[model samples]
Target: MQFRYLGRSGLKISEITYGNWLTHGSQVENDIATQCVRAALDAGITTFDTADAYANTKAETVLGDALAGERRESLEIFTKVYFPTGPAGPNDSGLSRKHILESINGSLTRLKTDYVDLYQAHRYDFETPLEETMQAFADVVRQGKALYIGVSEWTAEQLREAHALAVDLGVQLISNQPQYSMLWRVIEPEVVPTSKELGIGQIVWSPIAQGVLTGKYAPGQPLPEGSRATDEKGGADMISRFMNDRVLTAVQELKPVASDLGLSMAQLAVAWVLQNDNVSAAIIGASKPEQVHDNAGASGVKLDADVLKRIDEALGDLPESDASQTRSPQGRPS
Candidate 1:
């Protein structure tokens, strides 16, 4: 597996990071999730990403169990805060000092690790003072619960503000996790430039547009049984925006390009995201072990100028690049 330094930080992470977002403790059986993690390790992936909010905190436990015997020093495990977890109390979410502090402890306990390689704010907390959140993150670093700080789906301005605060607080803000793919180019216009200026790399999720770019959901066809589009366990909601015929029809155009490159549609999609220089890693999740092995092949695959242009032509204005789409919750979760 190819590894890249996250932003300007000294740490290097596998270009393909195994993430358990919708699968681990919710969609897939525990044994399958463990096998997927095992597959990732067998494919030379050393980075694993999860969140405390995933499956109401069960995802971390499953990942921890999956990674139980591995040498800790050889893996980069990351998790996040900023979503309503536990009982969904008044203070159960957001980046408030209490939540960030308590969440880290809970996350550490669930992950079966003393410290995460990087701890992230899952989303920007509009209700909490940025100072309070960054200060709490700095404290997380000082306490050695997390080695570095990061954020997810934060706007460029938010990143700028947080990076400044992180510097003032004497902590490193190294990465931003966002949904970035061939079909979801929302981060390219603004977030990428700002993160580059602030010395932050992107750990992009949904590099396949939640499987849309895999050419599986064809236009004029019924939604595949058990596919993410048919999943009611939050996956359907996340992948719904890209389910229209216009998008699906356009996605099918990339099949030949994948064939020409001797790549599968999924590999083409993942490689397309990694072509962006500022992207440190692309997070891939799986329901089965074979899926992990297939997607992992995208690592270290290079797409040249002509192939990139052909991809853009095939996608043709179907990609979403609006900077305004890079958003956080309007209010604190309750």
Candidate 2:
């Protein structure tokens, strides 16, 4: 697998990062999750991403257990903080000093690792002072609990503020984990440029548009049985937006383009995201082993201009590229 440096940082991560968001310890059994992680490793993936909030923190444990025997230095394991984990106390969430400090130890304890390669704020915490959040991250790095810092889904303005604080605090805020995909181009207009200038690369999630770009959810057809949309433990709500006929039909049109390029729809979707130089890695969550194998093929594939044009024409008006539409999460981390 191809690897890229996270922004200007010295850390190198696999271009395709294996993530377990909703699948591990919730939708999929621990054994199934272990099989998926093994599949990722077999495919040459060395980066794994998870979060403290995923499946109420069980995801980290499953990932840690799955990765037990691997050489720690050879893998880049990333996890995020934010949202509520454990009991729903007022201080149980956000980027507050207490949460950030307490969360790291809890995360390390559960993951059975002394330090994560990168620690990210899962969402922009507008409620906390930016100084407090950035300083806390700096402290984490200083204490060797985390090697680097990042933020997810932060607006350009929020990123700029955090970037400045990180610089002042002498911490390297290396990446932003945002919801970016073939359909969700929300970060392209502003976040990408701002991050590029700030020496931060984007590690994008949902490159498949929550599985919409795979062309499996056919127009006028019922939700695929046993799919994430039909599974309550999976990300049903996130995938629901692309369930409409308009989006499904447009996604289906890209199948021929994929065929012409000797690619599957999922590979096409992943390659489309990697085409953006600002993106360092694309995070893919898998329930089954084969799904990880399929996505790993997109790591080094290149798409030509004709194929990209065909994709644009097929997608038409469904792309969300407007910078103005990017907003801070409404007091909830998704």
Candidate 3:
């Protein structure tokens, strides 16, 4: 597996990394999660991304349990704060100093690690002052609870402000985690260029567009059984949005390109994202070990310039006119 320096930082992470969003604790059982993590590690994925709020804090526990013993030091662990993990009121969430301190400690205890390689703010906390948040992050770094800090789903202005604050406070903000995929190109106009200019790498999530680009869903077909979209609690809206004719047609049209290039639709979608120099890694979520193995193979496949152009043409121009419109959770332009 190929690796890249995370932004301008010396930390090198595998180009294809493993992420547990809704899979580890919510969907897959402990043994299944362990198998998936082991598969990813065997395939040379050294970075594992999770969030304290994922699965009500069970994800990190599962990950820690899976990585227990000999494999701990071989992996780089990244977890996020800034999300509510309980009903402790407003202070229980956001980037407040109280929350940051408590959340990091909670994550550390759950992960069974003294320090996290990367700690990220799950999203912008508009209610809190930027200095308060950055200073809290700096304090964590100083205390050795976190090595590098990042922000996720932040706008360009927010990212710049955070980076400036980190610089002034003498803390290095390493990367930004955002949803960026073939079907979701909103980040291209602002977030991508800003990250490139500011020397912050982007470890993008949903690189396969929540499996919309995987070609598993077809137009006018019943939802596949046991798919994430079929989950009773999750991905209902994702299924609806992706099952539309327009998205299905796009996926269908893109299939031959992937087939011709000797890759799965998921691999082609991931390779397309990794083609960007600003992207340090693509955080792939998998329900099964084989899914992680398939995505890991994407690290070696490079899309030619012509194929990229064709993809752009097929996907059409990015929806540049809708920057002000906030996207839905599925990464759809509003």
**Prediction-by-prediction clash tally:** 0, 0, 0
RMSD of each: 0.7, 1.2, 3.1
Tens-place lDDT per residue, model 1, 243-323, is 999999988899999999999999999999999999999999999999999999999999999999999998899898999
Query: In terms of TM-score, how similar is model 3 to the real structure?
Result: 0.94
Most accurate candidate by TM-score: 1
TM-score of candidate 2 against the unseen true structure: 0.98
**What lDDT does candidate 3 reach at residue 88?**
49
> In candidate 2, which residue pairs clash?
none
Models ranked on lDDT? 1, 2, 3
Which residue ranges in model 3 land beyond 4 Å of their true spot?
317-321, 325-334
Question: What count of clashes does model 2 give?
Answer: 0
What are the per-residue Cα lDDT tens digits for candidate 3 across 1-334? 9999999999999999899998889888889999999999999999999999888799999999988884556778999987778664657778889999999999999999999999998888877888999999999999999999998988888889999999999999989998878877778888878888889999999888788889898888887888877876566655454566777777788888998999999999999999989999999988899999998989967788899978877767531224343231332111
Candidate 1 accuracy as lDDT: 0.95
Model 3, position 111, has a per-residue lDDT of: 94
**Which residue runs of candidate 1 sit more than 4 Å off their true CA positions?**
none
Local error of candidate 2 at 31, Å? 0.3
lDDT of 2 by residue, 129-188 (tens): 889999999999999999999989888998999999998999999899988998999999
lDDT of 3: 0.86
